[model samples]
Target: MQESHSNESQIQIRLVTKQSEYAVPDIPLSVPANIETAGLNELLNHLLKENKPDFLKQKQFDFLASGELVRVSLIEHLQERSVSVETTVEVEYIQVTPAPQPEDSILHEDWVAAIETANRWMLIGCYDHSVSIRTPHGKPVTSSKEHKNIVKDVAWVDQQQPSKGLVSVSHDLTGILWAWEEGTDKIEPRVKLRGHERGIDTVAVSPNSNRLATGGWDTNLKIWSASLDGDDNGEPASKKKKGPSDISTRTPIHTLNGHKECISSINWTNNHVLYSASMDHTIKFWDAELCGIKNEIVDQKAFLSSSWSALSNTLLASSADRHIRLYDPRSTEGSVCKVMFTSHTLWVSSVAWSKYSEHLFLSGSYDSTVKMWDTRSPKAPLYNLQGHEGQVLVVDWSNSKYLVSGGTDNYIHIFKNKQIFK
Candidate 1:
C-alpha cells in the first residue's frame, strides 16, 4: 500500500465479484483520489495473484460503478458522478461475457422486404408477394395470399381487438388489409386499397390507429383512414350501413406529392408526424395534422430506408451509398447528419433502433450482414452478425432480446446476447 500525502485525498474502494469463493477484503482499500481505472485494475490483478494466480490470465474483467460501466478515466468518472474523496465508491469486477451467437434460423422462400414485431407475433413481408406472421420461436401462425406482385412492406394496426389487423403494400400497385381471426390460422383480406399510379413501396400506420400512410414509386405519399367506413375525404359513405362493398372503394384523404423520385420508405413517429424517404435523395418530415411538409432533408445519396428512434428525437436513414446517417431533427442545421456509420460494404437496405436502448441500433446491408451499432461509438459496429448468404434486406430488434434479420437468401436469422439484456 502506498502512503498518502497530507494534500492527497483518499477514497475507499470495495471490490465485488461474481464468484462466491473469490473473497475480497471485508474493509475497503484507501486509494488516491486521482487514481485512474487502469491503475486500479492493475492493483486488483496483483492482489488476485496471491490467492488465484491463474485467474487473471484466464479471464478478463470489467469494472462497474453503481451499475454503469467505468469506461472513462477514473478522475473523469469521479467528477461526472460527483464522487468526492470523502465518499466510498463500490467497484464491481464482472467477467466480460461473450456475445451470444445465432440461436436459430428460419428459412423462407423469397427475399424479405420488411419486418415488424407486435406483442408475440413477428410479421414479415416477402418478395413472394405475401406477408407472414410467425412466433418468435419460428412457428408459423398464418400467411396472407399472394398479391399480384411482390410485397414491399407491412404495418400492424393498433387495434383493441384480440384479432389484430395488418396492412401491406406491394408492387401490385395496391395496399391490402388483413384481419387475423382468433384461435385460427386464417388471415382474411378485409380490404384492398388502390390509388397509387405505381407500385407502393412502404406503408405506416399512425400511432393513434386512425390513419394510414403509404408511399409509392409514383413519388406520392397518400394518407387514408384506417377504418372502412369513410370515403376519400374521411366522410362516412352515403349508405346507411357499411359493408365489404365500402372497403375496397375507399380512397385516400390526402396525396402529398413532392418527391421527384420514387418513395422508398415511410415512418410515422407519432399520430401527427410522418417521415418519408425517397430515391430523390431527400427525406421529408410531414405534419399529418396540417397536411403539409414541415421540414425537408436533402442529401447527395439516395435513401433506401429510414426509422425514427423510439427513445429520442434522432432519426436514422440507410443510404444507397452504403452508409447509415444519424440525424437530429431538432438541430439548427437543416438535415445535417450528426453521425455517419460506414462499415457496410454494400447498400444499407434497412435500419432499426432498439426499442429499449436510446443509442443502440441495427442495420442490414446488401453485403449480407447485420451490424449492431452504439451511437457512443460510431467508428465501428459493436457486433458484426454474419450468417446470411445473400443480401440482408431487413432487420428488427424484437422485444430488445432477439435480433432478427431477413435477406435475399430466403432465411430469417435470430441472434441473442445475454449482456444486451442486462
Candidate 2:
C-alpha cells in the first residue's frame, strides 16, 4: 500500500514559454509533486542545456500554472486551488529579470523630497529649500536656493533644446523657473509664479514645452506659459515690494477647480489633456482647452502621486491605502481601476513609468522601499529595492540606464538596470 501511494504522488508536467529563445520540447516529464519553483527552474534549465549558449545556462526562470505564479510546492499550489492532479499540468516559463545593481548613493543636506532625470542630468529637490542639478554619476553641477520653503517638486522643461529649462515648486506657495545651459555655473532664475493659495505640491511641463501646470494644497490646478523670453508681467521684479524677486512674477493663465481636497499630484499627457490626483479620493481627467474636468475615477483612498504613460495610454497612481493602481481611462464598460498591486505596507508615495518599456514601472512607498514591477506580472513585483532608512518620497525611471529614488533619509539612491528594457 505504501509503494502504491508513493507512485501516485508523482505528477506529469509539460513546460512551455512564450520566449522563443527559451522554448523547450513540449514533452511531459514525470516528477515528484512536492517540487517547488526553484526545483522546476532547475529542471527546465536542464532541458534547455543542449544547443544553448553559456549565458543561457546561468539564467533563471519563473513558472506560472493556471495564470498564477508557482510560488509554492507544485502539489500544494494545486491542492490550495482545488486543481486536479490526475491529468498533466501545463506550466509556462518566463525569463526572470536579474536584480538591479546599486550604482551610487548621493548624500543630501536635508530630506530628498523630489527627483527627476533626463538629458544626462539629474534634478533633485530637497527640504533644505534648494534644487540641485548633478551629472548622471552624482557629480554636483549647480543649484538654486531661491525658494523660501521646502522644495516639493522639480521637472525638466525641454530636454531636446540646447539649453535646458527647470521648474521647481515649494511650500512657500511659489514656482520658480530657471535656465541652465550645460557647464554653466548657475541655475539662473527666469520667472517666479505666484497664485496658489496654499503650498504647491506638484509640477508638470507640457509635452510641447510651451506650457506648464501646477497643483497645490489649495485644491486647485493652474497652467502657465513656460516662455522665458517674455518680460516681467508687470513692473520689474527687482523693483517690486513684498512680492516678486529679481525674476518676474506671473499668474496662471487658467485655474482648474474640482477636487474637494488638496491636489496632491498633476501630470500633462498632451498639449490639451492633463490629469490630477487629489486627497478627495479621486483622479480627475481634464481638457486643458476647456479648463474643466472631463472624467474622473473615484477611489476610497487619497491619492498621493500619479504618472501617465504615453506609450500605453494608461494611468498609474499611488494612494494612502498602500497600493499602486493601474487604470485604463479608455475603458468605458467597467471600473477604470484595472490592476491593484498590493505589496507595500505603507502609503505609496510615488510611481514612475519606464520610458523605454510600456510594461514596466516603479513604485516608492512610505515603507522605505522601492519596487520594480512589470504590468504583465501583476501578482508580484520584479524586485524590491532596499536602501532608504525612512519614507521614500519620490522615484524616477526617466533615464533608460538608471533608476533613481530619493527619500526622507536625506539620500538619493541610484541603481543601474541590467537590461535597458527597450
Candidate 3:
C-alpha cells in the first residue's frame, strides 16, 4: 500500500508546442513528479500515438520548463527554478535536430589550414605552401604554389563572377590576388601585396569586392584596393606563364592599428564596417572607411578566431580558454558576452555561423573535434563531429547544405543531413 501511494505522487503540468501537428489538449495534465526527461518523452509519444494511430515511429522531443531546457526530473526542475509544483506548469516542446550524416572526407597532401565554400566551388589553403580551388567532390580545379611559406588564409573576393577573384595571405608576409575562370586549370597571380613586417595570418574581402583587409603577427590591419577589371578581357592569364617582372606590387592604402598582439582573424560585415580578433584578448570593431576603431570588446582569454553573424547581429570569438563566445556589438554597456559554449576540452581555434539559420553555428577545437551548436540550447551541443586525426584548425558553413571542417589531420570532413532544418 505504501509503494502504491509513493507512485501516486504527481504534479500538474500543461504541454504546449508551436507545431500544430503535435498539438495536444490545452488542459492541465497530472503526471508523476519523479518523471525525468526520458519518461516525459515516452509519455508525450504515447499521447500523440493514441491521437494519430498512424504515427508508428516514436519521435524524440526536447522539453522546456520555465523557458529553459528540462534536463532533470519534472519536480526537480520546478524546485530549482523556485516554481510551486501545486500550480499548473507550462512546458514547451520542440523536435531535436537529427544527427548529421558523414558526407565525405577529402585527403590533402598537407594540413588543411583554411576553407571557404561557395555554391559552385571550394577554396582551401594548405601548410604545403599551396592554395587550391577544388570542386565540391574534391576534384582539383586549379592550384598555385606561389606562396613562399605556408598559406594561412584565403578568401573569394567575388562569388557571383564567372571568373572568380581571390586573395591569399601567407606566413611569408605577403598577400596575393588571383583571377581564375571556372573551367580554367591555372591560378593567375595579379597583384602582390607587400607591407606586413611579419607573417600575415588572416585575410578578408569586403562585400563589394573592391577592397581587401589583411591582418598579421605585427598586430596591424592593412587595407588594399583591388581591381580585377583589367583581367575581364577574353585573354586569360593562364595562357602564358608570368614571371616575377610580370606582376605589379602594391602597398596598403590604409593601416589600422589598435591590437597589442597578433591579429588572428578579420571579418567584414559590410563594405565599411570591420571586426578583428587578436591574441591580446580583444575584438575591435572598426570603421574601415575612416580607418578608425569605433569600439572594442575586451575579454580575459586570447582569441584565436572570430566571425560576424548578420542574422543574429552578434560577434563570435573562439578563445585559448577552450570556449566559443557570442557578444552583441550593439550593446553599449561595454559589449558584454551574451552567451558562452564550453564543451570543447581544448582551445577552440575556429567558429563559423550558418548562413541559413540564425541559431545554428559550428566550432572547431584543438581537441580534434567539431561541434554543431544551437543558441536555444546553451547547456549542450546539438551534435559532436569527430573526423580529424589531429587538432581541428578551421570550419566553414557558407553553403547551406554542407558543413566543412579541416585540421592538422590533412583532410577535409564534410557533414550533411536533410533533416537539419525544421
Candidate 4:
C-alpha cells in the first residue's frame, strides 16, 4: 500500500499527434511530480526517436493541454487544471500551423468607404451614398438615406449617453450628424454641417466628443462643436427642418488653412492637437487652442491616409508609393519616417494603428489586400488578409479583439483572432 501510494503521485502523460502519416503510437509515460512543459518536450523528443527515428527531424511540435497552447510550465498547467495522480493528462502535439486565418467574412452592398466601431456597434459608410450601423454579431441596426454623392468617411461621437451619435462626411460638400438610439431602428439626421467650400473628404471627433474636425478638397480643416447646444443631449435649441443649409447658421470655431492641395485625412489626438494630411505631400499639426500650426511635415510623395496611435507616440501614414511609414513626432528627423514597411504592390490607401498594441498596425491598398504589420519586422507583414475583390479602402481595429475592413468590392470583412479568446 505504501509503494502504491508513492506511485499514484506520478503524473501520466499521453502524447497525441494530429498527423496521420507519423503513425505515432499512444505512448504513455509516468513522470515525477512538478515536471514542466520543457521537461515534457524533451521526453516527447526522446520517445519520437525510439518510435520513428527518421521522423525526429521532420518538424517541430507544440504541446497543448485541454485545447490551450501550453506556454507556462507543466506544473502551472497542472495546478490550473487541478490534476492529481487520479486523473491522466492529455496533451495534444500539433505541427505548428500558420497563424489562424480569418474565421468569417461578411458581405455588404455598395463600396465600403469607411468603418468605425465603439462598444457593440459598428458604423459603415458606403459609396452608395449611405451609412449603416450594425452590431458586431453581424446584425443590421439601421441604414441612413442616400446623400447627394459618395459617403467619404464616418465617425462615432463619444458621449455619456445610452445611445451614441454618428457623424459622416460626404463628397456632396456636407457633413451630417445622426442620432442612433440603442435597441431601436430609428436613425435620425440631427444636423447638416455645410461649411467646407468644397467636398468634405474626412471627419474626426475629438477624444472628449466636445469638438469635431473635417478636412476637405478646399485644402482646409474646420473645427466645430460636437453638440448643437454644447450639452450631452445633442438636441438643437430649436427644432428646424433638415436641409443642406439647416446648420449653416452655426460657425466654425477655427478654420485651419496650410495645405497646398486637397486635404486627404484628419485625426485629433486630443482636444488641442489636430493632425491633417493632404495631397500636397505634407502633414501639418495644429494647436487648436492657439489656432496655429505647431509643426508641418513635408514629403516627396502624397499621403493618402494618416492615423495617430492612441497607445504610443507613433504616427502611421499610407502613401501613394505603396509603402506605410511610421513616424515619431519627438524624433529630430522632422517628418522622416522612423521605419518604412513595403509590401503592397499598389497604392496604400488607408492605415490604422491597433489600439491594443503599440507596435502593430493595419494597412489597406489598391492591391485588394489588407496587411497587418509589426513595426519590429518592417520587411514583411504579420498577416496578409485577402477578401476584397477590389481596392481595400479602409481598415480599422476594434477595441482590441476584431479587425474590420471595408473595400471597393462592396464588402466588409470582420476577422477574429482565435488567440484572443484564449
Candidate 5:
C-alpha cells in the first residue's frame, strides 16, 4: 500500500502490488490526512475485459457517497510536495466541486482556507458543510464546517478564546454561533441568539464582550448584553406581552429608533458609541446607555447655513443630496468643529475606515468608482478605485496592507495602495 495525492475534492489511494504481500504505507498526519480504501488487488489496476472480477470491476473509480469513517489515526509518512506558486484569476466566480458526502449543500466549493492541518495559499474550503475563513486579505488559514443555513455575515469577537467563535448571520433573522475547540475537530454550535423582528441585515460586536448589536428590516436596532461564559443560554422567544409601544425586555437591553427606513449598516467604535447607516439616506450616531439610547440631537445652526452645511459630529450624516453634515450630538452650541461631507453623483451605499490609517476613509456608491478620502480631505476624494463591473456593495481594509471590495457582479476585488488590484 502507498499514499496518494489529490486536491480537496478527491483522495487517491495508491496501492502497490509489486509482490503478493503488501502493507499500506503510512502518510504524514500533518498533511491533513483523508483516507480512501480499496482492495490491494484492485488498487491502481484497470481491466480491459468487460467482465472482470468484482475487486477489479473498475479503474480510477470515483466515490458515489462517502462511507462512514470507522476510526481516525495519525501517522508519519514520507512527503512529496508540489511546487509553491502564485497567480490571480479575474473572473466572475470560480465554482469548486465538493468531496463526495452523505449529504450535499448549495455553497460554492472553493478551498477558501488551508486545511486546519497546514497553512499557505487557498481560495476556498471543504464543500461538505465547509466554512472558509478569510480575512479582508485572502490568506486562508482557518475554516470550519458550514452548518444549517448559508451565512450572510460573520464576526470574531474574543481573540483569546481558545475556540475562536463566529456568529454566522443568516437571512431568517436566526443564526448558529459556532466555536472550534483547539486541538480537536469539533465546531459545535454554542447556541442560537434571537430577538430580531425580521431578517437581520447587519450585526456588530462591541470592543468589549459586554454587548452585541443587531439591525435590519424591522426598523430597529436591538442591543443584547450579558456576561455568559460562552455557553448556550438563548431564551426562547415568543410574542411580546406589552403593547406595540412596549419595549422588549428579553435579551435586548436597548432598542434604538429614529430611522424611517431599513438599516443599511452598523459600526461599533467602542462599547458605548454605535454608528449606523440607513436607507433614509442618513447616518446616525447613538450613545447606547443601559438598555436605552441617548436620542438627543443638537438642534444647532449650520456654519454654512446657506447650504446643508451643518457642522455636526454625531451625525457623520452624509447623503446623496450632495452634502455631508455634521450635526451636533448635543444642542446647537458654538462651532466645535466642521462636520465632514463628500460629493457623489449617486447614493453612497457604504463607508469603511482604514485599519492602519485612522482618519482615512473609503466610500462606494451606485456610481462605478470607489473614492478614497481622509478626515481632513472629505471635501474631495483623495483617489478613485475603478474596476468593478457593477456597483460596489462592500469595502473593507486590513492592517496588513490589503483592501477588499465586493460588488453586485459576484466578485471580490483585492487592491493594494492605489494600484495592483487582484
Candidate 6:
C-alpha cells in the first residue's frame, strides 16, 4: 500500500523476517528532497537482516520499508542481501498526519462545483463559471455552478498537510491561490500569483511538494519555490526570497520562450528533462537543469495541441490531429526515435501513466471515451473503457490497476477490471 507521514519524510521500519522471494534490479526511484535521513541507521538494525528463516520466522517479523514509495512491481523476489529494514522506533505515522498549523478548511466553493476526498482526485474548470471535484473512484462528490465567472484552470496540493492545507488554483475573483482545511467553512486566499500578465492556464506541483510550476496564456511556464528547501516539515525560512510580495514574487527559475503558440501541456521527467506540448503543432524537450532546448520535433502527426506528461524516462504527447506520440527521453540529439499511436477521434484532453506500471498509460479525449494503452506494444489500446457522455477532460490512475476519470458532461467514472480480485 502507498503511504506517507508528516513528521517524517522516509518511513523507518524494523524488519525481522529472513528476507525471501523479493529482489529486483533497483528502480530509478531516488530519494526526493522531502525524505528525512534521521533514524534510518537506528531502524536498520530492527530490520535486522538475517539469513536464517527459522530465526526470522520465530521472531515474527518480515517487511521492507524503503522510506521511499514504490510504484512498480519487483522483478526479483526479496531475499537476504536483496532485503533490508529499519527498527529504531521513536515514533512514526503510517498515515496522513493532521499537519501542525492552524484552523483550516479542506475544501470550499464560490458557488457549487463539487468536492472530492481521495488520493488521486481531479477538479475541472468549466468555461461557465463552475467547478467539479471527483473522487479517486470517479464519482462527483462536490460541484459548484455559481461562480462570478467561468473557472479557468484547476490544480491540487496537500489537503492533509496542516501547513499546505487546501491547495487549489482558480480564476475566481482576480486569480487567487486558496488554502482551506478539510470539513471546514473557511477558504482563505493564501497567495495572489499575479505575475502572469494574463490568466493562469495550468499548474503542477513537484512529486516532492517543495516547488510549484505554472503555465499560462501569457505564453510562459514558470517554476517557483513553493516552500523552503531546508526541511520536509515545509516550515517558512528566515532567509528572504527576492520580491515585494510573498507569492508570485520569486523569479521563474526557467522562462521558456520557444513555443510560438500557447503551450497546452508540460511535464517533468526522471532525468530532469522538461517537456512542453504547444499549439504550434510541435513538441519540444528541454534539459531540466541546463534549461536549453535539447530536441524539437515538428509535424507531430495529430499532436498540434494536446495535454501530455512523462513517466520515468518516457514522454507522451497527444495532439488535436488525433494521435498520441511516445518518445524516449534518452534519445540522443539529432537521433530522436519516436512511435505514434493513432486512436482518438478528437483532441486528446489528458494523459497519465500508471505509477505501478510504467508500460501502462491512459488518455481521455473530446470523443468522450477513455482508452488505456500498453506502451509495451506502442500500437493500440488494450482496453476501450466507455461511460462518459460528453468530452472527457481529465484522467488519472491511482497506483496501477484502478483508474479514475472525469468528463465535461458533469460525470465522474471509476473503471477497474474484475480481474484485480481474481
Whole-model Cα lDDT of every candidate shown, in order? 0.79, 0.85, 0.84, 0.77, 0.44, 0.50
Global lDDT of model 3: 0.84
In model 4, which regions exceed 4 Å deviation?
A: 1-100, 159-162, 228-249, 333-335, 420-422
Q: Write the number of the candidate with greater lDDT, choosing between 1 and 5.
A: 1
For model 3, residues 258-301, the per-residue Cα lDDT tens digits are 88999999999889998899999989989988888888888999
Order of models, best TM-score first: 3, 2, 1, 4, 6, 5
Writing each residue's lDDT as its tens digit, candidate 2 over 1-422 gives 22342524788999988888778787989988888888897788788886465545456887878766777787877776677778899988887767889999998999999998886888889999999998878999998799999999998888556265889999999998887776666568878898999999999988998888999899999988877645333234343343223576789888988889988888887889999999999999899988888888999999999999999999999988888899999998788888888889999999999888887899999899999998866778989988999999999998888999999899999999888643
For model 4, residues 342-383, the per-residue Cα lDDT tens digits are 999999999988776676678899999998776755767868
Cα RMSD, each candidate: 7.1, 4.5, 4.5, 12.6, 22.6, 15.7
- List, residue by residue over 64-83, the lDDT tens digit for candidate 5: 11111111211111122121
Highest TM-score, which number? 3
Give the lDDT of residue 422 in candidate 5.
Answer: 22
From the highest lDDT down, the ranking of the candidates is: 2, 3, 1, 4, 6, 5
- RMSD score of candidate 5 (Å): 22.6
lDDT of 4 at 332: 80
lDDT of 6 by residue, 211-273 (tens): 556665666766655553322224454466634233432345566677766666665553456
Tell me model 5's lDDT, rounded to 2 decimals.
0.44
Q: How good is model 2 by TM-score?
A: 0.86
**TM-scores of all predicted structures:** 0.77, 0.86, 0.87, 0.73, 0.52, 0.59
lDDT of 1 by residue, 1-53 (tens): 22342337667887887655555564588776667657777777767776675
